[model samples]
Target: MELGIFLLAAQFEAGDQGAVLTAALDAGCAAEVAGFGEAWIAEHHFVPYGVCPSAVTFAAMLLGRTDRLRVGTAISVLPNTHPVLLGEQTALLDQLSHGRFTLGIGRGGPWVDLEVFGGGLERYEEEGWAESVDLLMRWLTRRRVAADGPQYHFREVPVVPRPLTRPHPPVIVACTTPASAALAARQGLPMLLGMHADDTEKAEMIRTYDAAARACGRDPRGVPHAAAAVALVADSRTEAVRELRTALPKWLGLGLPAHQTLDGHPRTMRDPRTYTDYLCSIHPIGTPKECIARLRRTAEATGITRQLLFVEGAGTRERTLENIHRLGKEVLPHLQAD
Candidate 1:
């Protein structure tokens, strides 16, 4: 199994935006030094859900700082951005990073991003999102492209300065729903599963995805899907459990934003206690031995070989750094050996 760092770029009470951004990059650098294989950055807008609005730009910035750790957009919110522009920028990044970039695309959230980015959710839901993905895949892989879907119409245009990585860098999808999982399976793309689901739920979802892939005549075993969970490795189980219990609630609160949309649409409210139970049930948050057990259990249940750890959010930079280091030194090797 391989471990990767999942950065949320969360803003806490300190609210030092500069320091927070710097710490996020520093954490990636630290993860690279700690021997992580990949670093995934998430994109969000108009809220503290995620401060990094441009994941591709952030991936480029991280590439400049680290040498070997492959950087990826955990998702680049396809519905919110233009396919051509995203393709161009991603192709450039692929060249600049020496084919060390991965493109993880997803439909925009139901939150404020669609409205704020000038397209309504209805259009994206109808056809816009799928069309954007199709156009992006064509732009990255083919020389000349023509897209005349319901939501997008374009003549045959060359994807100038084509991606250095043949067939383009690995394109993963953030599969949130069963439909999205099936779509990814049909496309033969890997998926990034969120941390919200329990082990049983995740395993069932993966089974559904694999079955769908097989139904579409694709080899399900070849698809590499990653399951994410908030991880905090500590010296002792007691210490880790205490810290996680306290931070989990705070993190859940941040996941659901406090503010409303322009027309007064409220964020999805979550009870911390309920969310905490769901989180702890799936996450590996304990001593090295305990964490390893949880990770192994998850792998066994879901048949997922890669686990992305959410190491930063609602904690001191120092605390987050320690968690990263512990995960690398203590938790990673055992899992790798297995």
Candidate 2:
């Protein structure tokens, strides 16, 4: 299994924005030096989770800072923008990063992005999302393209300055549900799970995603499955547990904004009241060995090859950096060895 760093990009009450991004990049630079595979960033508008709303733009900035570390968007909700423009932006990033770009797409969160953009949750339906993806792939690949569809459209125009990377950049999809996973499989797109599901559920979700691909007559191994997860690794289980407990409610606060659109539309109903049991059930947090055990068990149960760990959010930058270094030093090698 390959491990990657996923910064929560949560706002810091004490620091400047440049410092926040600089700290994140510094940590990512360290992770690359530590031998991680990818540095996955997420995108969200008007959300405090991490203001790097342009994961691709962030990746562009990080390109010159690191070598041998791939960068990807854990996801960019595509329904909010045009396919051609999205393709253009990512392709430029791919060129700038020397082909180290992977496009991750998903329908924006219902309670947050979708409602704000006037897009519906039902748009995540296999057919519609898949069609949008098809259109994206088409625009990314074919030089001369033409299309007139319900969700998206295009004309037979010559797309110049084609992607620097061959076959355009690889595409990934964030699969939150069984149906969405199935859609990813049928489309042969790699599926990336989110940080909200725990060990058992994440494992099951990956299996369903892989199975869906295979059922679509595609090679299961060809479709990669990755999960974004919250992690806390420490020298002692007691310390890990304590920190985990202290940070649980803060995690809810961090995520609620992503659920609430920029308009603060209350769409996603998550009871921040029962924060512990609910958050604990989903986030993977503990000592090195404990974290490794959950990771190993998840791999055995679901066959996930890669996962991005959410290492920053509601924690001091120093603490987040320390946890990430410790994770790379302790937990990663053990899991990879297994």
Candidate 3:
């Protein structure tokens, strides 16, 4: 199993943006020293949920700072940006980082981000997403590409610099729903399952993805799908749960409610307290032994070998780093032994 950190760079309080960003970078650097294999950065706009607006920019900086740790965008929202520009950046990053970059793309929410970025609501819709992914894959895989899709129409252009990773730096789709999973499967790409869903839910998604891939005449068994989960290692399960319960809900409360819809379509955010409790019940938030057990079970159930741990759920630099170190020193080795 491969273990990595998911850097949300979330701001728990107002006017702490610098501190939050610095801490997230520090955590990325610490991951390398702590023996983790990769670090994934999250991107958000106009919200404290994730202060880093550009996951690719953040990833480039982190890639420069680390030698071994593979850096990826937890997702660079596909609808908000041009696939060509993103493709160019990802290719450059892949070459510059010596093939240590993964481009994870997703259809972001119907947030005001689409409005701000000029993507409009249609880009957030299914047709737009499918077109974007198709164009993106062509940009990554071929030397020269042209697009005549409804969302994007462009003349043929050469893929400059090209990608250091053969067939392009691995592109993973961030799948939150079965439709998203099926879409990724059609392209024969792996899925990056989110933390909000539990083992059973994730397993169902894997089944969905696998069936879809097989239907499309693509083998799913060799694909290394990833699963994200909140991880906190402490002396006891009680202590871990208590700390996360206190810190995570506050962060979630301030962050989740900040998302505004572009269209007047009603958007209902999850209840922070209930959601926190649910994550705690499903994830590895306990002693090293307990954490290992939970992660192992998740892997066994989902057949997912790549795991991204959202270690910053403790909501502070000190505690987050502590959790990362504990995970690297204690939990990681045991899981890797399997």
Best by lDDT: 3
Residue-by-residue lDDT tens digits, candidate 2, 100-179 = 87888887665456665665654555566777777778778878767787666555887655788777788888877888
Residues 99-203 of candidate 3: C-alpha lDDT, one tens digit per residue: 999999999899999989999877789888898898888889899999887788888989897888886788999999899999999998999999989898999
- Taking every candidate in turn, the Cα RMSD to the unseen true structure, in Å, is 1.8, 2.9, 0.9
TM-score of each: 0.94, 0.87, 0.98
* Model 1 residue 279 lDDT score: 70
TM-score, model 2 to reference: 0.87
Give the residue spans of candidate 1 off by over 4 A.
259-264
Quick one: RMSD of model 1? 1.8
lDDT of 1 by residue, 1-338 (tens): 99999998877554677787888889989999998999989888876666888999899999999999999998898888888888999999999999999988888567666777876675467356666777788888888888787767878888788899987878898887888888788778888888877788788888889889999999887578888888888877667767766776675576566544545666667797677666766688778888899999899888897988989733678988888888899999988888
Q: What is the lDDT of candidate 2?
A: 0.73
Instruction: After superposing candidate 2 on the true structure, give the runs of residues whose Cα lies further than 4 Å from its correct spot.
Output: 12-15, 111-128, 254-265, 273-284
TM-score-best of 1 and 2: 1
What TM-score would candidate 3 get against the native? 0.98
Ranked candidates, highest TM-score first: 3, 1, 2
Identify the superior model by TM-score, candidate 2 or candidate 3. 3
lDDT of each: 0.82, 0.73, 0.92
